[model samples]
Target chain A: MTDPTASAEPPSGPPARRRGRPSRAASAGTRDRILTAAREEFSAHGYDKTSVRQIAKAAGVDSALVHHYFGTKEQVFAAAVEVAFAPALAAPDTLAEGPADGVGERLARFVLGVWENPTTRAPLLAILRSAVTNETAAAVFRRLVAAQLVRRVAARLDLPDAELRAELAAAQLVGTALMRYVLKLEPLASADVEEIIARVSPVVQKHLTQP
Target chain B: MTDPTASAEPPSGPPARRRGRPSRAASAGTRDRILTAAREEFSAHGYDKTSVRQIAKAAGVDSALVHHYFGTKEQVFAAAVEVAFAPALAAPDTLAEGPADGVGERLARFVLGVWENPTTRAPLLAILRSAVTNETAAAVFRRLVAAQLVRRVAARLDLPDAELRAELAAAQLVGTALMRYVLKLEPLASADVEEIIARVSPVVQKHLTQP
Candidate 1:
């Protein structure tokens, strides 16, 4: 038995495997662990109530390790928001630079994509759930949603009230998500994505270029 | 003094002081009381979690009385929403039908008036908060806001995309409230109504009629 397994003596043998610019498996693995724990903690406790130590404890790592990896709670939230909002956020920039005629389709596809993705939708649901009761979390959410996403879309449009129109479009889309996914309303909840787009895209187009 | 007090009892005791109504109190008073209680409960617990029995109990009445008055929880909620959204709901149909120059000011004044009135604002805040986490609440909210408010405003305008534009305006205004009152963010929280109107009205006007 000793001859057969001579190389497995050290329980932490993986640490020795990194001999250069850091192994992808080691650093990426720790980062993933931290994010998974942070998502759970933030979703459960909300933004204002969630703490670094709590997140670290859940991740089975030292608190210092969380700070070393994520920097701050806001940064972690931003990263999470980036991931959660990526489909929608990425859409505006692409749509602005893409074929202008089908902006409605692009916008609808973007919203449906994000809401349909389970990985991002859960945290987004938590964020929406917390936004009402928790003031601080709501602020973070508003900034990420309004200033970051809607404002950017507004800036891209050539209309007179582009900013306002963009915000309006954002509201309908987000409100639909709140109603369908989080609230689980009847007709809307059961409606297919294409149906949602058919009904809603024209509305978005109106906002973008109706002037 | 005691002799005079005893003598006054002989005069039908001032008509027995009338236990329930008619003593300078209308039947509507009970409705008002129940609505007030419902607002407080919904604000604290949201719509899905708040029960009619709880609202009735808080109003110091029997649950049967609540059912007798409002018929069902949905009706009661609808009444509460109507009262809370009265300003916007009651915005003269003339505003939408009239010439569209000062619509920015009109819309701004209407929104500010609703937010400033405790009677309306409190219940509205509860409804808006609940919309974040509850589906039934959100659907009702969207129906009320969109049909009563947005559709009316859109119908008044001649633009092809009037409905979408009106919705966008609502989003900006509602988003501002969420940031200020619900989220309690700085600068926005402290900003005066006039300031908000000045900044937001042009945007609203653009949505209303910008060619």
Candidate 2:
């Protein structure tokens, strides 16, 4: 619920009756705006360089509002990561929809598609870049991937060493992303998404399915 | 050749006769010393945080000497990467010694071994951290991996999509390094070297040897 007092004090308008809590939509919108700005600032400046004041400024809100919403920069970052990786966090479910044999292709398609999409790729890149440099960010990132992404996929396999296999598959896909997206290594970077999926999916499939 | 002026000066000792250009070995030693200090400083502080003055102080030399040896911070970082990745840069030759099928195992063993070795891993970890955050460092790192490491392996493969395959193999290995060494992701981080070799080599083998 939005604070009634704050909602009632509108700029260039007479004070209206402070009715019941301002709409959930308005509160959620403010939270989303803060997160979007936080993602951009963190991505651009990394965890150490970014400040709450800067994020608040970027979001066009007061610093106190940011603190009120997110508590700390770390909390804000965690929320931002959650927002950025929401699609990827859901990607493990894609494993359930397809045949076991094609899980690798589906997985690869989903990951590469995320990287190829501007919407997902931007924040993911920022998180990735931050993770690489900042220990705190890296810890958060590790938990997200290991607990949420990799482990979830590992759960799908009805086999021994399922966790290891899932991680091996992650290593291949994450490695591909490191090179193609982050490092921008040529040929691989310039290669079509389809080509990458073709070459990489089998390896993923093999890692996931092989004994 | 080391500078005659620098070599003549000794701490708490009589000044030796100022000679002509110092021996190649002496000059090389200074360069190596500077690089070692650079690696340590860069590792501890990262690229943006590290300064030539600090590096020189760490190396027991003047900032001018650091500049004299490595030209700029970028050049110093390049030299440090070269030193850190020397063994890995030479890894392609290992493929030539063994049968083609075993190359994957050999490659995995060599890479994981490098990561496992604390002596090499320390500076490498620093370079990796720097590369993730600093664009300039990333460029140097990209050149080292693409030009010196991955491309060399691709050249040895002699396959139709040799470059792509080599990179895919690199992607897997690099990804593993990212997770295990950089991110310190669980299981993989603590996973036994041989166990990882057992699991990852086949995928590397597949990426490399497959049509």
- Among these predicted structures, which one has the highest lDDT? 2
Residue-level error in angstroms, candidate 1, position A17:
19
Assess chain B of each prediction and give its TM-score: 0.78, 0.87
Which regions of candidate 1 fall more than 4 Å away from where they truly are? A1-34, A37-122, A139-211, B1-27, B92-98, B116-119, B158-162, B184-192
**Per-model TM-score on C-alpha atoms:** 0.60, 0.87
Model 1 chain B poorest ten-residue lDDT run: B1-10
Candidate 1 TM-score on chain B = 0.78
Error of 1 at B149 (Å): 1.9
Error of 2 at A124 (Å): 0.8
lDDT of 1 by residue, A49-71 (tens): 78988987887766665666656
Q: Which ten residues in a row have the lowest lDDT in candidate 2 chain A?
A: A8-17
Predicted structure with the largest TM-score when compared to the true one:
2
CA deviation > 4 Å runs, candidate 2 = A1-23, B1-26
What DockQ does each candidate score versus the true complex, computed on alpha carbons?
0.17, 0.65
| Cα shift from native, residue A128, model 2 (Å) | 1.3
